[model samples]
Target: MLKKAIGGSLAAMLLAGMVLGTDALSYVTTACGNVREAVKSEITPEFELDRIRNEIDKLMPEIRQHMTVVAEQSVDVKDLQREIAKKDTKLASQRDAILALRADLSSSKDSFTYRHVSYSRGEVEADLANRFESFRNGEEALARDRQILAAQKQTLRANQKKLDSMLGRKQELAVHVSQLEARLKTIQASEAVNAIEVDDTKLSRVEGMIKDLNHALDVRESILETEGNVLGRIPVEEDSVDLHADVVSEVDQHFGLTADENVAEAAQSDSL
Candidate 1:
């Protein structure tokens, strides 16, 4: 809205106040007041717009960072899902293979029933070695798959946590943006220019707050390499009992073979 110019009527009204009739002076007073109102109306929107711009600028970087994570997480979740599917298929295949091997081993041990030649000891031993070796290999492979799945799940969980945290922060920042927008919509500017000066001070304070918030967000460094590792299983250490030590001690105690005693006994025998 165009602010009506308050030309010289305000000064004229004050100077002519003592001589002018009450009705004419009242008209001049009202005109000056309308012009002030119009100017105030114009300034208010600009003030609010400036404030909103400052606030939005403060929040945009963090909001954009979270948005980036949201997109990345979408891709990560899909990849994890694919990996789980592949693992499940491989696990099932290995398990089926183990079952088949077990059946073959068991059936090989059976006596002759219907045109079946029973396996001899050598054949049975060979079959056992084959079946057991396959079973061990399959079990080890399955265990590795389980470990990989566990690590993947751990990674997924970490990513999910970060996603949730970022989403929450985004929501909070969005609310702040909306509030500033609403404030702009309803603002009323003061007629005094000093009021604008005070607001400019407030703008400075708001800028400082934005700086503090930005610093806080900047300092929030994330933990690196969230994925876990599958460590190879180590054998447990224990104290080992040595039977040879006991046997050697017992033999030494029983023999009592002193060199001086043996020499004296041999001398006595030589004399005899």
Candidate 2:
């Protein structure tokens, strides 16, 4: 009975040890799986960080090259702007110079003067004096035309008086014709007719004189009508004045230099 009890207790102790061993084996297996999962999760993040670092390292040279190109383009743009500014300044200056020349030409054209009349009659120290005398002579001639016109009017008046006399004589001749008709009715004698013929010859001579006087009066009236128009018939010295003005204009156009206000203002605006 003691040996059987000892064997039963040994069997119980062996079963307990077998159960503890199984429990320990399951715990070790579960802990090992948890440790493996943790290690996998930790190593995954490290691998991702290393991949990103390598990619960045590979792209560094290309990024630096692109940045360098950008820097160089910026410098080129600055230089181009400076050159454009310089060209614009030079063009403005040239335009201002051209404007100044135009202004000077305008000023010179305004300033020029030309002499209209000049005279030197045999070097009598009378350039202006001779011209003045010529002007005076023209005035004198105009005055003379007035005087001659007055004289011609007087002659016209005299001719008109003679025409009046001729008109009276014509009326008298009509009266004599009526008287002869009456005499023809009253008396018819050859000797009396010869006496009438002599009287007729005298009347005919008076009629001829009247015709001449009327013609003379007409000529005198025509002379008086033409006297006022004589001034219009005088010639003008157009070539001299035109030549002088053209010469002065050409000289001013070629050699003058004067600036305008608008050009100066433009230059100032460009500088600003």
Candidate 3:
């Protein structure tokens, strides 16, 4: 109902715009274009394919009608051709009879005999004149019939060609529709395969939390080693000895003094 109302409103606006001015009409056209695009967005490929199939189905009845018409026309053309052939044979016989009578009259005969009946020259001439007139009229009628047959044959050929073209186009459209449906299915399948549900925000938070935990653990380990002073520095014997305390001991050893405290006093007394 809402969609219908919106459509009605759009149509009313378009009519009003068209009645107003070209600029308003242009605006209405743009609005309709936007609506058209919106409608197109909602229409799926499957729906369009179904519509195409329905349209193709509709054409079947019309094509069948055309086929029927062409078939009837073909029958009619064949009948006409047979009729023309029979007339042509009859006309040929009539023409030969006329030519024979003319040939007999040209010989200056006073009378003529035909089928064991003798007729005077006047009777023969009158009979020949009537026969020739009849033949002429028949030839004219046959000529007209031949023309009609030719035209009918041409019409039948055209109708047959049109029918063939329609059938061919129908087949092509069916194949094209099938191809489109197959391609649409392949694309849908690919999209379904490629679509993965993953939350980027959650994944990023997890990575950040792991990094922060590692940093905190490293800082705590460093603090513990510094406070305990256990294996904090390299173990060496040189670090254990005090350099200031060793200086007097090194001097006493070099001088070979037995009493380090009395050496200086004894040297002073000896000097005195």
- Tens-place lDDT per residue, model 2, 1-272, is 99999999888667756877767556657878999999878775336545645654565575556556555655655565565556556555655544544444444242322266333332223333454455456555555655655565565556556555655655665566556555655564654676664577888999999999999999998897678468575434333358786875686577562346546766999999
Clashing pairs in 1: none
Q: Count steric clashes of candidate 2.
A: 3
Local lDDT at 208 for model 1? 99
Clashing pairs in 2: 103-258, 104-257, 104-258
* Per-residue lDDT over 1-272 for candidate 3, one digit per residue giving the tens place of the 0 to 100 score: 99999999999877887787668867778888999999999998889999999999999999999999998988988898888889889889988988988899898889998899999999888988998999899899889988998898889889889999999999999999999999999999999988977899999999999999999999998897677666566555235778887987887788776684557777899999
Pairs with steric clashes in candidate 3: none
Q: What digit string (tens of lDDT, one per residue) describes model 1 on residues 1-272?
A: 13334546565666677567667668777888999999878785557667766775676687577667656766665676676577567657756755654566565454322237665645555655775676577667657766765776676677668767766776776687678667655553334433554567888999999999988766653212122122433324446679998876676578895657768878999999
- Candidate 1 minimal-lDDT segment of 10 residues: 221-230
Best by TM-score: 3
List the RMSD of every prediction in angstroms: 46.8, 75.9, 12.8
Score every model by TM-score.
Answer: 0.34, 0.24, 0.59
lDDT of every predicted structure (CA atoms): 0.65, 0.59, 0.88
Task: Give candidate 2's error at residue 14 in angstroms.
Answer: 61
